[model samples]
Target: MDMKTTSLPLSDQLLEAIEERIVTGAYPPGTRLDEVDLAKVFEVSRTPIREALIRLETMRIIEKVPRKGWVVTPISPQSLCEMFEFISELEALCGLFAARRATPFQIQQLLSAHEACRDVDDPDAYYRANEGFHKALYAAAGNSYLLEQLTEMQRRARPYRRLQLRAPERIKASFAEHEAIVAAVLARDEGAAAERLREHVMLQGDRFNRLLQSLEGFGRAGR
Candidate 1:
């Protein structure tokens, strides 16, 4: 796979910012997204905001009604479960392939990114570094199509995953999971890497229940 990239355009930048807000519950379910107000907030014209809204609609993060304009899509518990289930499988594939195929250079890069995560005290910094660690795994998988699909799913799930970071002791646990995954990859143990990755990616068992409770609390607070 080619390792080329481009910076996000103004519209995409706005889309990510707005999406983050939506995921973080700043603009909870049913919140109206006014294009003109967004344009003013971002100091950009309506064209970019319009484009961003269109992309959000495509992601099912928002929807337009006949006369109600665009509103944040409500996330049901079932939908959240389904999203994480898909993400878990996708990332498991990435880890499996990466363990079987990663080059020495790629392994070193993954370690570096993991180390960066360990060094960050701020949640945002850790989040960015965590992203780098996962992207390295995707790149190491050596499949362009899988990388593209996984990237999109990851982007869509970013907010929920970010919320997980706020859970008690989650950062430390996440880093430990990353360590295990990195070790599995370096050892060329495909099954171990895949299983570890799945567990790490999925909000299952206790984690899933906790997140559901938190979301419920957030919904009540918003009302």
Candidate 2:
């Protein structure tokens, strides 16, 4: 909650960089992580890489595996589903409160963030924009505690969520959902906004299964 208040130390910088690669699927779940290689990649020493991995392990984003050393934590279907369920409800709450409490300027921020998500060609670009829109929504809720909790949940779900957009046409579908969410919020229709936001973010049935497979195949060949 207190993050980004100051310039990051070297270990923290490497921590975020490694976290980015893990969430972006550059270092997929189940892939073994070598501190030496990571040090080389970041042009730092093993000391910082070790510190970063220790932090990631504490967060359970990566773990020490027997015989394998450090590896990205495997995504369990149940755990992923549980996280999404919580996130969906939390986001729904954000929409509900934003509809009721957001200022005109906050609404304008939402509009701008939503527009940023428009017309993005690449999945990563769209993902970044999508993240911005969600952050704007979270802030618009006008509750500091809710913002903190939701942002933490979003952090934990980042890896799975990022990969979900890679499916063909998925980004398009997501954008359509966003439109409905924004429309409901702008109208100050709290119920509609909540429902739209919940439906947009839920991971279940076919979508859940496919993502589980992808997350498990999950790793590079032979990983």
Candidate 3:
């Protein structure tokens, strides 16, 4: 399968644009994003704009106003921390299970996805390919219920994760982390896979610090 598609679905393209703007501080929390304005900006009709807004609403990245328009959702630091903690543990559990249960075919899929990610330089292209990598890992866990939960948690954290990848040299760092994760899983080292996956999912040191600084700036702008 061609793992990297340069184009996203129309609504998804709009969603990514708006999401990038919000996470990067171009559209701070509580700033209004009107359908008409967005439609004009994206050169699309209101239909796709509405669809994108609805998806963002589900992700809790934006909210519908009472007859006004949509606004970016404000995220409290505590809430952001809690969400990341939840995703970290959830994905770590997946990695642990995957180490024990992933079939040879699944491992190959994981490696392929990683290769796709490595071949892409555009952040958006890499972002899409990166989803394939994680999805492969999630499927390899061999637990449908767990996968469902992790998928929802991942959806909720999507915007922040995209922002995380935008940090300087973060794409390389993330790929390196994935390499460690892949090696651990290939070795059937459950403990190592779990630890590496947790570290990969959970922001720390410079990355977490940078994210906190951005959140603080967004918070101040919203206030």
* TM-score to native of every candidate shown: 0.84, 0.80, 0.89
Q: lDDT tens digits, residues 85-130, model 2?
A: 9999999999999999899999999999999999996775687799
| Winner by lDDT between candidate 3 and candidate 2 | 3
Report lDDT (CA) for all predictions.
0.84, 0.85, 0.86
Per-residue C-alpha lDDT of model 3 across residues 121-159, encoded as one tens digit per residue? 666667788999999999899999999998888888998
Q: Number of the top candidate by TM-score?
A: 3
Write out the backbone clash pairs for model 2.
Answer: 215-218
Off by over 4 Å in 2: 1-32, 41-59, 63-71, 220-222
How far off is residue 203 in model 2, in Å?
0.2
The C-alpha stretches of model 1 lying farther than 4 A from their native spots are 1-17, 40-48
| Top lDDT hit | 3
Instruction: Provide the global lDDT of candidate 2 against the true structure.
Output: 0.85
Cα distance off (Å), candidate 3, residue 219: 8.0
Candidate 2, after superposition: displacement of residue 3 in Å?
A: 24
